[model samples]
Target: RRGDDGTALDRLAGAITYAARLIAGATRRTGLREVYSPSSSTRGLRKLDSWVERALLEKDESLSTATAVAAEAIRQDLPPLFAEVVGRVLLRIGRLPRDMPDAGDVAYVPRAGHHMPLPPWLPPSRILGGFYVLRPIGTGGGGSVFVARRAEERHEETAETFALKVPAYNGAAAHTLSEEEFLRLFREEAGALLTLPAHKNLAGFVTFDAGAKPKPILVMELVQGPTLERLLDKRAMSMPLALSILDGLAAGLEAMHAAGIGHLDVKPSNVILRYPDDVGAPARGSTPSPTPVLVDFGLAGRKVRPGCGSPYYGAPEVWDTAAFGDRTDPRATDVYAFSCLAYEMLTGKTLFSGDALPVLIAAHLTHQDGPESLQWLRRHRQAQGLAEILSLGLRRDPRKRLTLSEVRISLAELGRKRLASLSWPLRN
Candidate 1:
């Protein structure tokens, strides 16, 4: 009875080892007579096989524990390095025993070259179908963005532009959100945008199409401007210009809020600056410029968009226990982000500086008033007389925050004051 059981274990280990080799795409010429067939030392072979099977079947998560015990038990009787090789082989097959650290054994290494299985649903395309690709622009976590021409249009003469976002092949799988769900959301975005009406200050969606293969491509008006993050990297903004940029952005937010839509992710990357004739102003443009527009609705949500600001710009309310879920006021969140941006614009530095550790330390300090933060506020006052406006605008408490309407009124006043500062030049 014991001999029969030993023979069965021998066959099982051989079969499992073969399967592991096949998965690793190793050639049949692994040069092991004992592995492919019975050997001269059948007694030794049977002994090693029995010990290896018992070790592998052990409940201990650490592969090294099993391998070490198996090696010691069968080393004298089995072939010189047979146990060592088989242990390495098993690890390559992803059966690494957990919880065994520093076991003084090399796990497993397989020869490279096996192509991983590709998902059946995702068909490869030389060029993405359904849209005429003009140029590839950038890529993000969800997909690649491209500048593409619209396939069909209402009027032949009306030149249209669209930013096409495509999901990338992560070399693992090809799957997508359901076509119906994507279309429904797409239509919802377009409908909401139409009610709000397209403007120079907002990056508007024209339409969305899910190509026959079920890949979604968003069509939006081409918005041009360096991201606010990029602008802040170069230098600080003058008080008058920062206010000008904020005014335009606030107006755009107001329109969005009135239409019952809240931009959840209102970071500097989503904010774009457009200047007349493609020539951005030297600083923030005290004079009339094109306008600043907001982009990226991928993270945009409806129903009082929650705290989605970047970690650095995120308000205190974002971490509050009472601020759970998406019910927090969008205006308040945007206002907080606006203050962070304004602070960066005037100081040429992030409100929280240095690496992630230092930044996180600044974020959690209860008594930290952020000295650099106060400098920008003071300079804005000196340059543009926005001292009073920013005083309450930058308040950490949401209850003390000003509404977008209040911000708009304050900005219009700032604009008038800036224009008044040049009262002599206008008179001449």
Candidate 2:
């Protein structure tokens, strides 16, 4: 059995290497410049082989760490597009347990003439209505987002690219709903997003392909910059920067609510920050201030539903399955999630921590003062006002929570006051 497991792993590794070579070749042909010089490509392949070997040998260590190492090596030596494709392939293979038996690996190996499932990042021959997929930017909630450009595009240009979202269900999620049902849900989301007009703080919707061959796809303007989640992982921002981000998010949420829609998922992962010059068109040489935009309406709806959002950021009401039948206000749920985000930004810590849903729900229901570390925010005059605003927004009851418009107004007022007090260059 052990020898069989080894053989299976070897076959899987060989398949992965073939897939990587294909991806590398595709990127070299499609990208503006060669993703890797000949020397770097050889070195990258050697590093990937080493990482995979180490991952198979270290049964106690996490496979994800090995994948990360492989991804980083590729990213440093190759273009981002190439790195994205190879990284996704490694991630899919890494998900299997290091000690898993041979039978469990059959699905990853191709049969007589069949091929293994392509990594979600790899662009299909057809990417819905002439949009050429470039690379994947993000993934969540049974969907994957790919950076794409129009069919008539320049190799060296980044300005005309967009993000394309398509269904890529993971594990059991793929079997949970029929293809028809999945398409219906995708259309429903697309329709909800279309109701709102375009705003600077919101990700712009370009088009929706409901008549696509396999499933519906959502095309959106690709904002350039790291996600708030990625930014926070690197370092925490200053108070003023954090507030600015929150203000932008509040503005976007207000627009959604005004259109009678709500973004149920409001975590940092769903927020992308682009500089002023980065909006609309990418500026070549300029240092512009960062602006946040709310993205990913996968879990958004007119009404709140149980089991619909990230547990740590979900409102108390979202966790109570019994109350799902009631007319729960999605706006309130957005506010609650926003507050959780605000708490994390300010304190650099999550508001709640638990592996169980009930515990997470209880944390939201019982903790009223927000994060204890954030109590220091009340010491500063402008921050005090911001804290009070968040307090109202974080209220457990939907009726008691401040409306999205009200939150935006309050944040604007605080910004104005802070601007009045700041020194010359900082004031602007």
Candidate 3:
């Protein structure tokens, strides 16, 4: 019996080693060449190392022995980083020994005010198709975003990194829609992103793996800066910086509109601010120019239902989806939301704020005057024209709203005026 157990363990270890190789190869093909490199000091590698070490040194000897032995053999047999990854995979899949104490009986004590740790069942580390999920970056009603790298090795110099968006089935169960409907919506989002063409100001779509087991994953370029919402949380932005970001975002929206794609959800939270140096090489002592990239196209479409986006950013027609239905122009909705974002950027305050969605919607529908935050901006006589430009986009009547191209042109003129003002003082 003991000999049989040893043989079984060896076979499991071999399977785990093979799985590791497959994962490494897949990531490599996706442009993650350094995934299994021992010398690489990436956060993902560090987390894997820590998890493996903890599993190996677990107090339950019976439970840890198989995994530890397998991990040690892999460490000796494979490359250092590869061994660590394999060890983690094995630990994730390996069953607890029969002799171990029941996990249910083990009570966990929270440390002071800190919340109790999430249940173990919550995190299943199984490989989802070919993408190895590194860590979750954000979660929303639609889905969760993970920092994932391709596991297959490809003949490329730099491995491509991506943000994987997966549907949140767990939370979707309580939603009004059925599980099937929710999943279909998720798939639709992936399809929309895949069909869109590459644009500099738009988040770059890499690939969509709908065939992925369990759930489909949408892969997009991993932008390395904070969202505009987060930036606003830190501090208010300068006029020049705000206008530059607005220009980039307007251009992105224009491209999407031209492609017959309407990003219904165009708020500060969905805009990422990436510095020029982050995307490519920069000149020496070059001033950092942040480019705003529009993202989160989950609510985007040429003709989408009106009630899909955040209430605070929704256009007047969007508030009553039941009445407007499909007649709602998604482009107009985007313009309205873009105006709200622009207002927030100009003055670090949201146009509407409330706990209830209905109240927020009502405010958006009934409130005719511009945001109070913009009043200060308008007070700056030099920036009055900028205020008027934004007003045109925020017009309650969708027909009166400025198209993305018009907004872009208006912003360009405003930018020139602001630049001239700055240089005029210097010339004097």
Candidate 4:
């Protein structure tokens, strides 16, 4: 609607009001929690976040002017969209004091300079019953992981730390799982980690509290290192380092299977390279790196659930019901998933790399042949042997897939040193 006085300040304010209503919705509520139901297909928070991003990036004169006016014109009762933008700005310019939800809660977001501010929705209280939450490390589908240490007044003793996993539904907008259901999963994860024996390769259990007031929490041994995903992004690995990482991960998976547990999810990101404290950096060199520890037991356990885990690395049996279904071998699935990671490690690209989840699922179910990366492996010495081993693991039939033990034996049999790039790899 063109106004009589298009450039006037009053016309601009009126236009902004009209736009906010039209965008957010005419009759819909603008406050948090009331805006969208948990099961609502179109989540309000995500919509608000998109608008915040749009406002920040918008270069159009009229749109930018409208955004600026909204930023300051909010006298009180800020809408979720405007609230998110203001919160982001406030977080950027520090001076956020810890707002204790309870007394004796000496809460503070440690290394505020190092970490991007924890969003307003997930503002964690430092004290979680008996554990001291240090800082947020990462978040996943049902919960968030934080670097935590045992509650102790003696600061020096607090050197020993743990990864405190707390069930968080505040930002579970993408998920359809109810808050109670998510928390139940978190509890099961804690149980699974607790059941497994203390192994160097796995993220060993520390403790957990299922009956905590607001929500439950799971504490695990904090693996101090970068994820394999981050490492892969930084540089291509040498043949030895790559093999070494594979060996470590295999051992962990083997151990899990032996104890009647299945690491249904096995990918680069799940593997953590735990380097010695003395080591200067993660870069490959003469210095020894320990067996890469595997973390994230969320999808882990002996139970057979169809169509689960990361789609990119899911095996044939994992994708199909008629082929294997609930009778699928957990060990074979892990081996196949590991093979996918191994393929990516040796070659610097994912096998079935794409965005379409459905197309990728179809590829896993039908396509068993080599991807485009095979040409890159051509003319190499150990490529043939490695390819053979990988073929056995990546077979469409779960029955034909290599067992973790079989994989380990085959890898040990290889004369990997012949692969010239077996010792020192480039960082780039």
Candidate 5:
């Protein structure tokens, strides 16, 4: 350990720079001559053996130990760049002796790699980047969200709890890009969150630091509420509550689309009904005036990206992306998904369900009806005009889809009318 400040950040930057130099050197050589003269390049495969032993002797245990763990996990299967032999060191947890070492560790990415199901484990209270990690709230397609608070409580605004999303970059996604490039994409996508227009119905982004070692983190205002999916499982929402939620969701979508971004995954699970100080069962009349907060921006980005959305919610263009591909407007996918959401919200029913994804995709593409929840629509059309508006949003063609502004306007109009309670599990 060449002593400077012996600070964790300094040591980490040194380690990252060293490893990058090694990879850069190795990539410069090719053919049998390069293989025969391994040491001439980046000191060959033996570099890793010595590198691990040399990392973090005089550094912060929390960050250094975590980096060691992450490096070990990532190096389990290093990819060759354009046929250059990138060294691979496969690691497996043989067994941990009962010594119970000084280091506090959690979040094992399993043999299946980063995309695997969230392993059940209680993360010990620790500092991750600048946030004090409390506990994980949920894991999704792209990241794991944790309930955390700022490490420094000096600022009044930074004192509140925040949702911290740590990336779970898919292994398959990095097939074509170098490790550096993939990491850059993660940073770019996370930074895009800062560009989102502020709205009351959307979870506010506090900050994003992609430079956080091992993984980047995003912070957002944590709303106290159950996911809309979880809420609906208990009982169907009342007329005013459902309509109010619909209004909030549409408004959020309008903001995103107007900003030229899209909340591609606009489903029940992503919407949270923000309640009072005590999170409780949603009461009558819009859950005693709760605000619907649209959360989860993992897949939220430019309309052209986020290719598709949640199953049963994605539109025809999204479901068959290969056929539609670049022609599909990303924002249109949200409009379609919102329609599916609105349908289920009112009728306590879904238009399609299948055990397999292909079956589900087939249902989405071929689905046709005057109104998706047609019978329920027939019963409620006399009372309010939301059903037809939803039908327009669900149009198969992306160009034909309802604009977010249009949906917002419709919801605002419906908000003024006295709506009859939607008999969920509807019997027409």
Candidate 6:
């Protein structure tokens, strides 16, 4: 049985490696704009492996008889982890997780009927009565997100669809972030999101839903698209699609950096492709095309803590746990995640691929060369101006990375080149 288990693990590892390679190749070819990769996460596999090992050790005859116990265990355990990971990554990338049936067998977000009233704060009526009551779209450590429609709707000649987020009913949460803390966090998130004004690549907050609840919700623009992470699983994106995605994400990050907001979790799930109509883009001539919008500012703040963000995308500086504080510059954190997501977009794989626990452990505890793309760029010194810029943003040393402003300037230059090419008339 042990031998069989070992064989299974080996097979699983090989399959993962193959999948990783395919994603990597696809990303480079696709030129992904957003830095979200579903393939970047090994949590699914980790859940499965942990379950199998635990069951095998427990010597539980009933669980042992179960067919492909790993799959069953993963199905059961993955939903929660999926929700948690998706929430964190989305907050970083600046988007919400979509209901993707095809991405995986497990459904992370609960259905409408399954929605239970959260604690002293959220009752069904309050939820249904808020500014605009839509069904819950997502849930995370912070709270639940609903696709709300304004009740007594008012827009400053700039009406937009918005999402409302409220606190969850977890008993333990009371101690962590009190009702006041929750409201404060909501404002913090709102302030950060609002700072990043309108852009094709960013989802902006319209207002703070502080009507009744102590833990206020945020009313923000509704982004329409599946996350980049979900897209990577079913298939690799076309190079053109990838480039389009990355360009938009980079631009969004540029805006965020300029606004003093550093997206701490720049992963595949956080970045999304938004439709033209979603961003209210006019269907006329020479208008900027709708692009990926970076969403979720739940974890974004002025000073990101070292090792306090997602392990997969955390900067190399995080390995030195003491590097973050009031004095720490947020742009450095953004650069690290920006580089990781950029690499994943280019490679269709996570910067670090292994069991989730191991990969995270390595990212947190060990010193290793940054993403291979950084090395690749170094090897080809004369690649391109854009390539060089990406390399600079990807440097391991926080001080050495390009500031958010620098990244924006470089990307704008690239955009100019692209526009120039598009505008050039045929030379007869």
What is the lDDT of every predicted structure here?
0.52, 0.65, 0.62, 0.61, 0.61, 0.54
Roughly what TM-score does model 5 have, to 2 decimal places? 0.63
Q: Which stretches of candidate 4 lie over 4 Å from their true place?
A: 1-126, 152-159, 167-189, 282-284, 304-308, 317-323, 369-382, 415-428
Error of 1 at 127 (Å): 7.7
Better of 1 and 6 by lDDT: 6
In terms of TM-score, the best-performing candidate is: 4
- Which 10-residue window in model 4 sums to the lowest lDDT? 1-10
Which should have the higher TM-score, number 1 or number 2?
2
Candidate 4 local lDDT, 1-428, one digit each (tens)? 11111112223233334345454553364543433222111122223323333333343222333333334444232456855665454233123232325545645433321243343544255567577666666666536777767768425563887777775564322244576765665577557666788888999877778766555777777776656875565453667777788888888888898877788878888887777862423334445765699986656766544555577788876666555756777778898888888777766668677778888887787766444444445445544577777778887778888789998878766735353345433112
User: Which prediction has more favorable TM-score, 1 or 6?
Assistant: 6
Give the residue spans of candidate 3 off by over 4 A.
1-125, 153-158, 169-178, 185-189, 279-286, 369-380, 418-428
List TM-score per model, in order. 0.53, 0.61, 0.61, 0.63, 0.63, 0.58
**Residue-wise C-alpha lDDT for candidate 6, range 75-110, written one tens digit per residue:** 343344543543343233112122324647745433
Clashing pairs in 4: none
lDDT by residue for model 1 (163-225), tens: 766643332112333546545654464455556667667888666554535455565666765
**Alpha-carbon shift of residue 60 in model 1 (angstroms):** 70
Residue 22, model 4: lDDT of 51
On lDDT, the candidate that comes out on top is 2
Per-residue lDDT for 312-365 in model 2, tens only? Answer: 888877777454445788888898888778767765667678878677778876
Local lDDT at 49 for model 4: 28
Better of 2 and 5 by lDDT: 2
User: What lDDT tens digits, residue by residue, belong to model 5 across residues 202-311?
Assistant: 99988878777557777888776666874566453576677777888888888888777777788998887777764554333334667789987866766344234777
